[model samples]
Target: MGTTRSGEAVGTAFGEYAVRPVRVGEWAAVKALRLAALRDPVADIAFLDTYEKAVAQPDTHWRERTARAAEGADGMRQFIAGTADGTLVGTVTVLVEEPGTTDLAGFPVERRQGHLVGVFVRPGHRGKGLTEVLFEAALEWAWEVGVERVRLIVHPDNARALGFYRKAGFVESGITLPLAGNPDGHELEMVIER
Candidate 1:
């Protein structure tokens, strides 16, 4: 329902999808949508975080997360794209990780950076270029927050994810981290420097 970056009247990109922040107190919706993503076929390779753990989190957890991503301090943002019908089609979160501080990847983050995570587009919405729009919004927000670069990691075998990220101007950094939840799960780190 909001205007685009140019302040033009917004219309459906492919007859759906409007990128916006998840509403406050929409924690229930957030929880359910994420559970659905966790059950997706590639979740094993897509996320180091799990649905089982997510669903088990208390209402307060969802509350805190939504609040932080939606309206919290300036370090993070969660953008969800949805249909005109209000069905969430895709989601991603941007975390501004500062230099001299360790990041989620357990690496010594040397410069200010933004990290993208929890990216998912529902089965019905894949291939509509929705993810690219979502990434653009995130990358813009990261730069606004003064990060020098933005980074993401995907499973080594996930060509689809790699393709999307590459098209979005991310390049492999030749760095990898073992998945925290699985012994064999390894992630390919990619980044776009501002």
Candidate 2:
């Protein structure tokens, strides 16, 4: 995959959709997509945050979040898939973790890597290979940024996502992260080396 500008369009099976990093001014769209994702049926296991929590956040929170990701600085970038008419239908964010730095889970980062998070696609856009396109753009960016490998954590109960990740060439890394609320629950870590 080649590098794409913020609004450059890419053609996919369903139609013309742009798979590119979001612009800083698109904070409202980012917040809306996130809220929609949180409302998904599998969101409880698929995401670490809740719709109520995200919806309650102020505009400044969303603006700052989008600004940071839009800047692609601090090792974070968020890519969104939008239709020709400018409707955002999906998103995926990549966060790079440096060696010796602790991850969000408080686990020590043993190597420089890209961690995929906040992956989501609208229900109507499912089964059309849109997720793969999104992943390709994200992985391309990650590899270009010098990550040795790319990884994502999925809850054990999210069979749909687990199947997709496996099919996408990610293998279990033998790491399990304790779930935030459920002491007995854990997320399985999957990785793909560059």
Candidate 3:
């Protein structure tokens, strides 16, 4: 049943699953999935925001967030994976960064690129090749828009994510940022050039 032009179903272990952008009216779904992600066991290292803070956000915030990444947005896009039953199982967002602008970390963008963020998959859906499929879709969008490269930040202790990103053709860029809370922890930057 998943067959929207922008939301083609990618093959999955159980059957077919769609990977597409979030819709304007689907803010609730986006908010729910994000809260679920923040509740995940690895949330501490996997995400920068706390579950408490995310849940505290007003509905308008979620609405604006979804709208900014919806199908018509120019600077960002959020891709979600939906099952045959219409349940969202995972998501990823890509933000276009210009060379002259600064990023969330206050560092110069340096190059026009796609910054991948809000990456997640449900606990039950791990290791089914679904993540790779989602990534393929996101990267396709990034290239379609002419990004020079794509990059994501990962905590050094998050071995699972590091392994997955590496398998997906990303390599260490030799840039690391100090973690805010823990002085010794670092988030390593990984990139894949077009």
Best by TM-score: 2
What is candidate 1's lDDT per residue for 1-194, written digit by digit as tens?
24555423243354466877676666777777788889999898887767888888999998888877876355888888887777777888998888788888678988888999999998888888888888877887788778888999898788889988999999999988888867876788899998
User: Could you tell me which residue pairs clash in candidate 3?
Assistant: none
Total backbone collisions for each predicted model:
0, 0, 0
Residues 1-194 of candidate 2: C-alpha lDDT, one tens digit per residue: 44455553233334577777877888999999999999999999998899999999999999999988987879999998888787889999999999999998999999999999999999999888889988988898899999999999999889989999999999999999999978998999999998
Ranking by TM-score: 2, 3, 1
Ranking by lDDT: 2, 3, 1
Clashing pairs in 2: none
lDDT of 2 at 85: 81
* Cα error of candidate 3 at position 143, Å: 0.7
Native-referenced Cα lDDT, model 3: 0.85
Give TM-scores for every candidate, taking all chains together and pairing residue i with residue i.
0.88, 0.93, 0.91
Using lDDT as the measure, which candidate wins? 2
**By summed lDDT, which 10 consecutive residues of candidate 1 come out lowest?**
6-15
